[model samples]
Target: MSADLIYLVLGLALLLAVVLPIALSRCAVSAPIVLVGVGAVIGLLPFDKYGLDPVSQQAFTEHLAELTVIVALMGVGLALDRPLSLLRPRSWRGWSLTWRLLLIAMPLSIAGVALLGWWVMGLAPAAALLLGAALAPTDPVLASDVQVEGPSVTDDHDEIEESDQVRFALTSEAGLNDGLAFPFVYAAILLATAGPVAEWGLKWVGWYVIAKIAIGVIIGVVGGWLLGKIAFRSARESLAVARRGEPLLALGALLAVYGLAEVAQGYGFLAVFAAAMTLRSQERGHEYHETMHSMIERLEQILTLMVLLLLGIALTNGLLAALTWPGVLVGLALVFVVRPLAGWVALRVGHRSEPIGVAERWAIALFGVRGVGSVYYLAYAEGQAVFPELRELWSTMAFTIIVSVLVHGIFATPVMRRLERIRAAAA
Candidate 1:
C-alpha cells in the first residue's frame, strides 16, 4: 500500500473508533460486528494487498492478539466493583463463580471439544487438544457489552442488589481463565513433540502446573503491591508523580509486569490480571482506577478493531475454504452443546448451596464468545509444531467465532437488561 492509501485507511479507522460506540449504543448491534463487516467489504475491493495467512504471519498474529488480551485483562481487573474474598455467604460469590468457571467448566470444555475434534472432525489427538485449549477461554476483548463499567465512587460492598451477576461472572471468568488456559496449550505442545510419556507427566504436573501458577501469583501480588505504593501511597518526596494523574503509568505497569512474568517463565496473562486486581484493591473507591481503566479500554478497543477487521479480510480471502460438513457440525456442537453443558455441570457442582436460577445459569453458559484469543493460541501452537490438519483447525475456529459474534452480540444487551429488571423486581 502507498503512503497516501495507508494514511487514508488510518484516518477512516480513527473516525470509526470515535463514532461507532455512540452509534451502536442505540441498538443491539455491536462494534465488533460493524468492524468485521467493514473489513470484509474492503477485502472484496480491487486493491492489491498482502495475504493474511495465519501460519505465514504467525509472529505478527500472536503478538497482536497477545497485546489486545493483556490490555483487556487490565481493563477488566480495574472495572470490577466487587472485592475478592473467601468469606462465606457475603463475600464469596465472586470467588466461587470464578473458581467454578476456571477449575470445572474450563477443563470440561477442553476435554469435550478435544473429543469432538478427534472423533467427529477426524483431527489428530494433538491437533484436537490444541483446538480445545485454544477455544477454552471466553474472550476478554469482544465481551465488553457483558462486562462491568469502570470503577464507580458509589459502588458499595453491602448492596449486593446493585451488582449485575451475569456481567460479574463473565468478566471475572475471562480475566482469570485467559492465563489459566496456557498450561493446557503447553500440554498439547508436549504431546505433539514428545508423545505420551511417564516421565513427562510428572514434569508437566510439577513445572507447568504448580511452579508456573505459583510464580505468576507471587509476582503479580508483589509487583502490584509495590506499584500501588508508588502510584498511590508514595512517600512525601515522591508524591508529585502520583499527583500528576497520568494514566499511561497503567500501561507501563502492564508491560513491565507482563515482561517480568514471561522472563521468569510464568504466565504473563495471570500476572498482568493479578497485578491489576491488586492495584484496584489498594484503593477501591479511588478515582485513579477509572482513569487507568479508561486508558487501557481505549487502547484495547483500537487493537480489537484492527484484529477483527483483519480476521474478516482473512475470512473473505479463503481462511475457511477448507471447512467441511463435519467441521461445521463440530463448530456448531461446541457453541450449542459443549460450553453450555460444561458450564452447567460446573455451576451445579460448585454452587450447590446458593443455587442460581436455571435461566441465569444457562445465559452465562451460552455466551462463551471466542475471539482474538483463539486465533492467538492457534498461531502460537502452529509456530511451535506443524499440524497436518491446520486448515481444518483454522476453519472450525473461524466458523465458531463468526457464529459467536453474531449470536452473542445480538442477544447480550437485551438479555442483560432483562436480567437486571428481574433482579430489580425481586429486590
Candidate 2:
C-alpha cells in the first residue's frame, strides 16, 4: 500500500508487460493470462490491506477504466487497415461483417443476457438490463490477440488493403460497439429512475438511441476530418503535424474530439473511435498513422496492465464474496452460450450477403473477449444510478471477464494458426 511498494509492483509489472508479449507469442498462453495469474498470486501475500476495493474506490475504478477503454478505442481505430467512409456507399461493402456483428449479434446478446438475468437469476428489471448492456460489447484492450495489427504503409493509397478478415471483423466490432452500448445502458438507468416505459420510453428512444448516436457520428466525422486537414492536408505547412512527425497529435486529437463530443452531449466513446478511423482514413498509406497507433498502443498496454493486476488482486480479496450461484450461472451462460449463439446467428444471417465460411464465422463468434470496457460501463452506471444488486453485479461481471480471459487466451493461438492455414489453402 505504500508508495514505494506500489512503485515496486508497477515497475515489475511493466517489465512483464514488455517481455510477455514476445515470450508468449508462439504459445497458447497470453500476456493477460500471465499478468492476471501473477496478480492473483500477489494477492495471496500480506498485501491484503493494500488491495483496492471496487466498492470504496468506485470513482477511481470508473475513471481508470474509462481512460483505458478510450485509449484502446483510439489504438484500434488507427490499427484498422480497411477504409470506411460513411459518405461513400461503396465503402460499406468491406465492412459488412462489422455491421452485422454490431447490429444483430449485439442486440440479440443483450436481450439474451437480460432474459437470463431476469428469468433465471431473478435480478430486478433495471439491474438485469444493466447487466446485459454492460457485458454486451467486445473489449478492444484485452482482445489485441484477436484484433488487427497496427497499420503498415503501402504504396497504393486507393487499394483496399485488409487485415485478416476475421481479425478485421472482430477489431471493428470491438471498436464501434463500446459506443453503441450506451443507449441500452441509459435505458436501464431510465427504467430504474423514471419508474416505467410509459414515463420514459419515448425520451430514451429519441435522445439515447437516435439523436445521440447521430450527434456522435456527425461530430466525430467532421471533427476528425478537420483534424486530419490540420495534420496532413492543411494549407499552411506548419499546421501539418503529420509531415512534422508529431505522433503525439493522436493524443491531442483523442482528447479534443472526446471533450468536444461529450460537451455536445454525444457519446464520447463513439466520438473517439469515429475520429480515429476518420483520421486513419485520411492518409491510408502514410507512415504517420503507424506512428500514432504505436504511441497509443504502448500507453494502452500499460493502463491495461495496471487494471488487470488490480482486478486479479480484487478477485482473491473479497470481490467475489457476494457472488452467488445465480451470478455464477449468468457469468457462465454469457461466455458459453449468449455471445457464441448470438454471434453465430448474426453470422449465419449474413452468410448469403458475405461469404464467411464456417471457420471464420466461428472464430469471430467465439472470440468476443469481454474485459475493461465492461468494467467501465458498470462503474459509470453505478455512478449515475443506484442498483440494489450492485455487489452481485460486480462479482458476476468480474467472474465473466476472468472466464473470457482464460478461455480465449488458451485457445487463440491454435485457432488463429489454423485459420491462417485455411486462408492459405483457399488462396
Candidate 3:
C-alpha cells in the first residue's frame, strides 16, 4: 500500500465509521458486521498488514482494546437514564434485574465456559478460567443497539423511568460487569503464576474480590461527587464547567476517575463508570449531560470502528490459523448455549420483580453480546502471565466475538423491536 492509498483507506474507514450507524439504523444488520466485512475485503488484497497482528503485538492489541472499553464504559454510564444509589434501598428495586444478572448470570456464564474450556477444549485450569473471565461480560460497545439510547433527564431524582427492562438490564450489566469481571481475571492470573487455589485463594478473595471493588467504588463516588460539585454546584461563578456549557468535562472526569482509581490499586473500569453515574446524578435535567455523553459516544464509535476493522483484518489474515475443532466448539457453545442458559437461570427472578415477560427474558438471556471487553480481558491476562494455550486462546476468543457479532448483531434489532412493540401495547 502506498502512502496516499494508506491515507485514502484511513479516510474511507473513518467515513464509514461515521456514516454506517445511520445507514444501518433501520436494518437487521449492524454497523459492526459491515465494518468487519469491509476490513476482510481489504485484507484479501495484496498489502502488508503484519503491523496489525494481534498475537505478535499483544501490547498494541491490549491498549487498543483497553481504550475502546473505557470509552464505551463512559458512554454506557452517561447514556443510562436509570437512577442507581448504592446507599438507597428503594432504588435497588429498579435494579433488581441488573443485580441478578451480574451476581448470578455472569458467574454462572463464567463457570459454564470454564468447564467447557477445560472439559471439551482440554485447556488447563488457568487458561480455562481466563477464557471464562474474558467472555463473561456483555460488552457495552457492540451491544449499543440493545442498550439505552441516551440519558433522559426528568424532574424526579428518585424516579427510575425504565420502560424497557431488556435494554436497562443489558446496559447496566454491561457497564458494571466489565469492572466486576476483574476479580475472576485476577484469580486466573494467580492460578497461572501464584500457584493453586489453596495457596492464593484467600488473598485473591480479600484483595481482588473485596478490597479492589470497594476502592474503585469509593474513588468513583468521591471523584464524581467532587467533579459534580465543580461542574454543577461550584460556588465560584467562573468555576462551574457545566454551567458554562463545557461538555468536555465528561471526558476529563472519566479519565481522571479511572486514572485515580487505578493509581489507588482499584478497578479503573468500575471507577470510570461510577464517576460517570455520579456526575450524571447531579443536575438531572441539565443539557450538559447530553453534550458530555455525545462526546463520549462519538469517541466510542470511532474506537469501536477501528477495533472491529483490525479484528476483521486479523480474522482474514491468519488470526484463526491456530484455531482447532475444540476451540471452535467452545466458541460456538458460549454463543449458543452457556450464556443463554445462565442468563435464563438468573432471569427467573425477573418474573416476580421486573415487569418483563417471557419473550423479554429470553431476549435478555440470549443477547449477551460479547465484543471489545473480552478482547481487553484476554489481552490483559496474556500480558500478566503465560498460558500454554495462548495462541489457542486468542483464536477461540476471536472466533467467539465474530460469531457473537454475527448472531447477536443480526437478531438484536428485530428482537428488541418486537419487544418494544409489545411493551407499548401493554402500556
Top-lDDT structure, candidate number? 2
Which run of 10 residues does model 3 get worst, by summed lDDT? 1-10
How big is the positional error of residue 137 in model 1, measured in Å on the Cα after superposition? 1.0
Which tens-of-lDDT digit does each residue in 279-363 have in candidate 1?
A: 8776666677888888998888878887887787788877888898888888888888999998888878857765777778888
The digit string of per-residue lDDT tens for model 2 on 68-117 reads 99999999999998888978899899899998999999999899889999
**lDDT values of the candidates?**
0.83, 0.89, 0.88
Model 3 Cα lDDT, one tens digit per residue, 1-427: 2465446456766898778977998999999999888878777877765555676778988988998899898898888887778788887887889899999999999999999999999999999999999998999999998999888765665563667888999999999999999999999999999887999988998999999999999999889889998888888877788878887888888888888999999999999999888888788877788889988998898888878877887888888888999999999999999999999999886567666688998999999999999999988998899999998998899999999999998999999889989978888
Q: Model 2 misses residue 355 by how many Å?
A: 0.8
TM-score, structure 2 vs. true: 0.97
lDDT sort, best first: 2, 3, 1
After aligning candidate 3 to the native by TM-score, how far in Å is the CA of 98 from where it should be?
A: 0.6
- Point out the higher-scoring one by TM-score: 1 or 3: 3
Clashing pairs in 2: none
Which 10-residue window of candidate 1 scores lowest in summed lDDT? 153-162
